[model samples]
Target: MTGVSRLDDPMPDSPSQTTPIPPVDGVLTMFYYNDLQAAADWYHRVLGFEKILIAEGLVLFRIHEGSQLALVGKGYGSQQPLAGTNKGAILSIQTRALQQWHERIASHEAEGIGHELHRGGNGRTVEFKVRDPEGYTIEFFEWVE
Candidate 1:
């Protein structure tokens, strides 16, 4: 208790207790896959994400400082992957090294990685999209000044 705050302390009604709570410390987006290990390996090899943790049916990769990507095996979670294209969503990551990432992903011969890197219509970002082994779209972009 030396360096920690306790709710049971004398200041039970302190502002900290009444506040809406602190800002979100991090974010993790989950993608369901029938082949979890294959998806995990694809993310690691294609994107070069670092594996921060792994479990029975889930593997977490750190995208950056506070963002993570979670790959969940089918039947392990509430959601299961669809038999066809899972176009429900896309994961877009903002980075300053877009070209570097483009080069790395291109070398892997990943599907959809052949798309040319182009600037946004708004002229604010340069980006390209690549499909993971499971057909998940992962977009990498860099904001322009």
Candidate 2:
């Protein structure tokens, strides 16, 4: 045989390569509601979220620093059990001022209709749950430690 290297042989001096992963900046939570306008208004009033963008049947809001809350119009075949109910899925909001956050949510008359406050898993966070007009539950909390 001739003194030549095989074509299918792996290279010994080449470094291993890896695929680059994309960085996650933040999360955008989507909630489906039958009445998009009503749901948007309710979230705006309750969570102090301002409308960032409004499309055909969707409304996007900037809830906090890096988080976004999107309200999608229902009846587009994306229905879930929690779509028109307020008992499923817990949306959490993290804050630095627990007491102030609690006070602000507690002071709302609309919150009094369905808002409940409790201690978190570690006992270092205070959480409050409230429902929007479309019957979607949202949980807001602040870290005490």
What TM-score does prediction 2 earn?
Answer: 0.69
Model 2 per-residue lDDT at 112: 33
Candidate 2 C-alpha lDDT tens digits along 5-118: 344554455443244457879888887777788878877876678899999878899977778988888664365425445445657777666556556656666543334567
Regions of candidate 2 where Cα sits further than 4 Å from its true position: 1-21, 80-87, 111-117, 122-124
Winning model by TM-score: 1
Give lDDT tens digits, candidate 1, residues 1-145. Answer: 2554443464757687677767988998999999999999998987889999999999999998899999999888888886655669889998888888889998888898755789873666789988888888998888765
Model 2's alpha-carbon lDDT is 0.68
Clashing pairs in 2: none
lDDT at position 9, candidate 1 = 68
